[model samples]
Target chain A: MDNSVKLYLPTDAAHIQTLKPNTVVQIYGTLYTARDQAHKRIAQALKNGESLPFDLHTAAIYYCGPTPAPRGKAIGSCGPTTSGRMDAYTPLLIEHGLRVMIGKGVRNAQTVESIRSHGAVYLTAIGGAAALYQSRVTACELIAYPDLGCEAVCKLTVENFPAVVSVV
Target chain B: MKIVDSNKIRSDVAKLITECLITPDRAVTNALRRIDTDSELEAAAAALIVENNDIAERERAYCCQDTGQAVFFVKLGDGVQCVGLRDALDDAVRQAYAAARKSVADPLTRLNTRDNTPAVIETELVSGDTLEITYLAKGAGSENMSKLYMLTPADGVDGIVRSVVDAVERGGRNACPPLVVGVGIGGVTETACTLSKRALLRPVGVLNERADVAQLEKLLLAKINALGIGVAALGGRVTALAVNIEVAPTHIGMLPVAVNLQCHSLRHGTVKY
Candidate 1:
């Protein structure tokens, strides 16, 4: 298993290394953020044939709704929420050429199956390492759905953004 | 008739809530200490921890927006009868919620009905001159995954371990990982369940009175981590932060064990008056 890769947006899972169930990996790079509300909006946009605020192809999505940033910081302690909540929407994202997902919790059978079929990797983040994570986000900006508060879709620029890739 | 100061109770509860908001709890803080290497699990945990803190800070929110079913374990002191202890406690919760709501969002969703109640009170009268209240805000995720089992003597420790571990496994990614597992042993059926929940009140990494039980906690901790449940079950080595067991003497034929878990967003505060 490759020890590391720079995670990014718009990347296709099929193009990356073959991902088996429960393989571990370290991810570092820019990743798009989303959670319950944000995922719904993205899917809705896809359904309408409308261009999403950000491209899904070749992208990595972190399932999260981050709090506002501290003074002079890029972001607050941002942690991944539970992944099971997004199980229904993940396969669709995978179909759109999404390559990696960073979050916590187990995925539905179909979600894991989609990863295997699509060559996608799922990364596990420590569920409560909020403040420590904020240190890695070198840059951040709201890209869409600003009204969603913490759930608003945003773009995060990270460096050596550590994550364990588990294929389970 | 003994009289207790109701206002003191309100003040104490409010103070506890505020302090809890400002600082990340020990469970999260300790877990941060373990993220030494750049594994997928640590990175995932690091990434999510930032978000958790951000919500706690920027959102001006509770450490977990699921302020939870605020369950308070209150100990009433002897000779000190507090007028409206329950009402005053509830009022304190209400006030704290109002004071802190701007920063922390409520945990309710269109899918949920409990919405915004802060603390559920479990009062016990003890011999003392001061009131002691332990506030545990049971977050929605892990609380939902908590389980209770009535095992025959045959189920044994292995069975208990399996039940607890299986709960975490079946809970999968739902109960946020690096979970603080509270295992209650020996009590009768329902008492076992209550013990498990109360066991969560024990600080992370705290051990049992019995060396055997403490060893069991360590054993369970190792096995659960081996599950590769990782943070949020994305998969990794650190599926649980710690395993804490609280045991009681049980009926001759019963080996009841209850397992309750606190997710990464474990939040509890204490107040003494």
Candidate 2:
């Protein structure tokens, strides 16, 4: 069953709509990494009408806080954190045009509603497949909230990043 | 009295954490292999785990990003004395996090201490002269979904089963399935929680020595799989790989039941001295 759908970064609404829950999705291109602290900061910035470091429209954020990259590696072992932790901030982000999230776990009711209404997708990365996930990332760099260390927002370039469409 | 060098313990713990992060216990891998992969999701998920293990082992990389909070359960021997055992554990965790990921942080600040130090060390005195240390890289996903219930003696066996099944149902795929369900029964409130976590260290599919507890484990396992949550809740017959219940004597009036979960990739090991 290698009929996995391929999704390139900067994907449009039409591509996301084609994704149903449980569909295997392999992603290519840029995906941002953010977890609890970074999400909190992003939410606060949005609430204050402060321009975010990255635009929310067409943005796909992975709920992750990865370890530091070792020598000769693009990034450290990176996998999805529990998506539910970001549930409170998610509806707001979705309202602002955040189209996709990658993480483990189910979302809260409000977050699920937001995901449904916004035509966004919540994808499931195999929770403990850190080494495998890391191999998919070709490049990584810290972009915001460096002080948060691993919790800092990062920009990652990946290819064939496998995930299952979890919530829609 | 047997005097041990603290440095040896520090280095040993460091190695133990490093090994556990990449290579899960043999029972965990075996359980993962045995998952009936009838659903494509379960099969695919299982493949990812196997590939992840391959990558981790071949490249010396972490199998999961959330290397988890370093929790060490120590069984100290009466005849053996070590002055810096605690410090050695703390130092070992710091060394391990340096190579992998630093998951420990202040709860209030939610900021990384940079060095993942100050491991949670639980110690009990045992009869032997060898110090035994059990390590569990407790991930946040499953941990966040843990439940603790305070039921009266009236709740009985039914209550205990409900508490476990309910927690697994509530957690669903978020707690990460196919899961190893750890049910802690009959302890003071907090002890139940600890016992539940301790239950996870047991080898997969192994029954408790107590026959009744073993039966409860089997019953709970059947009920859990019947939930049809499956792997990643993708829908199938195997939601839980096993159910392990750890029990202790508690107050006559109150019955405390706590359910803790470990994701399919249960990272744990034991080092004895």
Query: Tell me, what's the RMSD of every candidate?
Result: 5.4, 1.3
Distance from true position, residue B132, model 2, in Å? 0.7
Which candidate has the highest DockQ of all? 2
After aligning candidate 1 to the native by TM-score, how far in Å is the CA of B138 from where it should be?
3.9
Tens-digit per-residue lDDT, A2-89, candidate 2 = 6788889878788889888788988998899999888999999999999897888967899888877989999999988889989989
In terms of TM-score, the best-performing candidate is 2
lDDT of each residue in A2-60, candidate 1, tens digit only: 35554444445444664444444445567888988788888777778888887776567
Listed in order, the DockQ scores are: 0.23, 0.76
The iRMS of the candidates, in order, is: 5.6, 1.5
Which ranges of candidate 2 are over 4 A from the true structure? none
The candidate 1 chain A region of ten consecutive residues with least summed lDDT is A1-10
TM-score for each of the candidates: 0.73, 0.97
Q: Write the per-residue lDDT of candidate 2 for residues B33-106, one digit (tens) a residue.
A: 76676787888887677778788889888888888889999999999999999999999999988876777778
Find the 10 residues in a row with the least total lDDT in model 2 chain B: B25-34
